[model samples]
Target: MKIARLSSADIHWCEDGDPQGVPVVFANSLGTDLRLWDKVIELMPKQGLRLIRFDKRGHGLSSCPPGPYSMEDLVEDTRELLKVAGVHSCIFVGLSIGGMIGQLLASRQPSLVQGLVLSNTGAKMGEAAMWQERISSIRAGGIDALADAILERWFSGKFRQSDECLAWRHMLTRTPVEGYIGCCEAIAGTDLTASTSKLDLSVIGIGGADDLASPPELVRNTAALVAGSRYVEIAAAGHLPCVEQPHQFAGHLMTFFKEDLHVTKV
Candidate 1:
């Protein structure tokens, strides 16, 4: 466990595998924290890789400054953390909001990003009104009220009925309300189309077959924005494929890293 204490916020993070090995940084989704990647990390090839996972501001053990955060702020926080941790370059893997962060990071600090993976996310999420409504609902009743609907969008119906869903629901509901709302505000304002389109790095976009939050078409379109990006869809999974299908998810990532990024070259 580690904490990157930035001027803006304190970021809680965890790392595994060799410190001197290939570096891979992971940013989680909106509601979940670093733990969201536990299953995927367990199944990933562990030799010669330094895996770093961080809880975004307002999620997990990271500090919640206030409401109405900006996409730039989130991006800056990640930049600061990487600098503080002595990471010169890495293969950045981001899910949902985390994916959005990667788009920004690769554009802003190209030298630091060797390859990019955008999973279960879009360049632009929803309209301002929709995010405002979600924020209002959270303020009125807390995140618990949105857990059921969120889980439905996150996992398939059959998975929703299983015990595994219970843990995810708990994670969603336990998220700090301020953090959730702040990220909602950020997502509402972010439109990464311009930045993502201009990126020239090795990139791959992964979507779940059953994902409703960011459908396959949307994820594919985002991938299309980049010149040579690849796309893949995992079967029977929802928004968080890394959770419901860890091995499959990890396989897609490994293929990208080994083939595209050429881990040996790094």
Candidate 2:
């Protein structure tokens, strides 16, 4: 792991060196760190590719600044991360709330992005009413009130019952309440309906068939709004597709980047 400050706090990330491959930045969900991508990263063919993963401002080993960080702030934070890493334009891959950040960032600064991969997220996200209620609940009660609910949404009941992946759910349990609420604010204010219509970049949208967190239907609708974006739904997976089914996720990911698109991993 490497560390750099985006603003007042130090941001942390892990890098897989592949100078010849396309530079790809992967952002984790709201509460998790760069480690969230471990399973998926394990499957990707390095083949001289550069891979980057980062803990958002409030997650992982990163510092949790004050409350109510905006989506734009998150975008800028990512921009700085890329700049510091000497990345020019790169593919932006995001999951869950991370996907929301990717949408806004790609829209706000198209020059900084070469391609986009959005998973387990929607353009409009939840209804404004529901997000408002969630924000209130999180702020008032804490992340504990939402941890089990989120864990449940992210994985299947069978997964929870089995010890297939306890670490993933455990990470959610370890999230700080303040950080969760701050990210909740970011999610609440997020809406990329207009941005999706105008993006002029390569995009591959994906979601899990059984994702309660962000359904495939929602992801399909999001892809529909993106003009010509292709969509995929991993069967028998949940919100965290990469973890639930790593090989399948990698197959979809590699096909999207290398075969379908001319992403020249050189």
Candidate 3:
């Protein structure tokens, strides 16, 4: 229920675990809110780890502004939230558009990002025309118009037929039109390859084998941008692997933090 009242936009957010523990900030995908990380959070070890999740402007309970938000706008919103919350240094885990935000933030403030995990995302996500067409469709018929198609891209066929898929479908369809379109515009306009390539911090790129939105190849290529970044693929998962395979998804993150970054208590 916490809210960060940034001048540009009010952001909805929540935090878990010890305040003094090693900080880990999570940024969700385009259409999902902080709840997107719930299952993964539940599976993660709590001791000596601080986990934080937030709803970007126009998504979840956050205020919906005008259309066409820039990647810089999203990055600034995160920066303000972390500053107001007194979060100093941390590892940032970002999914989809969330990964783009992480790249921009880390490039701008390296001291704040100790490590990074870019999951289910790429530096340059999709062509401008594709996003524009989606935005147009959303504006005309609202989020429900493309809900089924989006879900197909987000999850595998077997998952789409499962009973649990209903809840996720609701999550996607219920998102505000302005919010969804705004984020789409941001993705359409962003290309972070040049900046992300220069990152020197610990990095890991995670992908789902069946992720149609951002395929494994795209994630692998994005990871290659950073000289020493490692890449892992979670089998039998789609775009939102954290939802379909929470344990496996969380395991990848924990392994990276513990083995590579020397984070304690996982």
In the range 1-266, model 3's lDDT, one tens digit per residue, is 89889989999998898778898999999888899999999988777888999999888899998978999999999999999888999899999999999999999999999999999899999999999999989889988899899998899888999999999888888888888889999999999999999999988999999999999999999988998899999998999999999999999988999998998765
Each model's lDDT comes to 0.92, 0.82, 0.92
Error of 2 at 216 (Å): 0.8
In candidate 1, residue 237 scores what lDDT?
Answer: 94
What's the distance in Å from true for residue 233, model 1?
0.1
Candidate 2 or 1, higher TM-score: 1
State the number of backbone clashes in model 3.
0
Pitting candidate 2 against candidate 3, the one with the higher lDDT is 3
**How many residue pairs collide in each prediction?**
0, 2, 0
Where does model 2 exceed 4 Å of error?
Answer: none
List model 2 lDDT by residue over 1-266, tens digit each: 68977775578987885866778899888778888788888777777568899898878888888878888888888888888999888888899888888888989889888788889888877876787788788778776678778878888777777775567767876776677778888888878899877887778888898899898988888877776788988887889888778788878777777765576643
RMSD to true structure for each model, in Å? 1.1, 1.6, 0.9
Model 1, residue 28: distance off in Å is 0.5
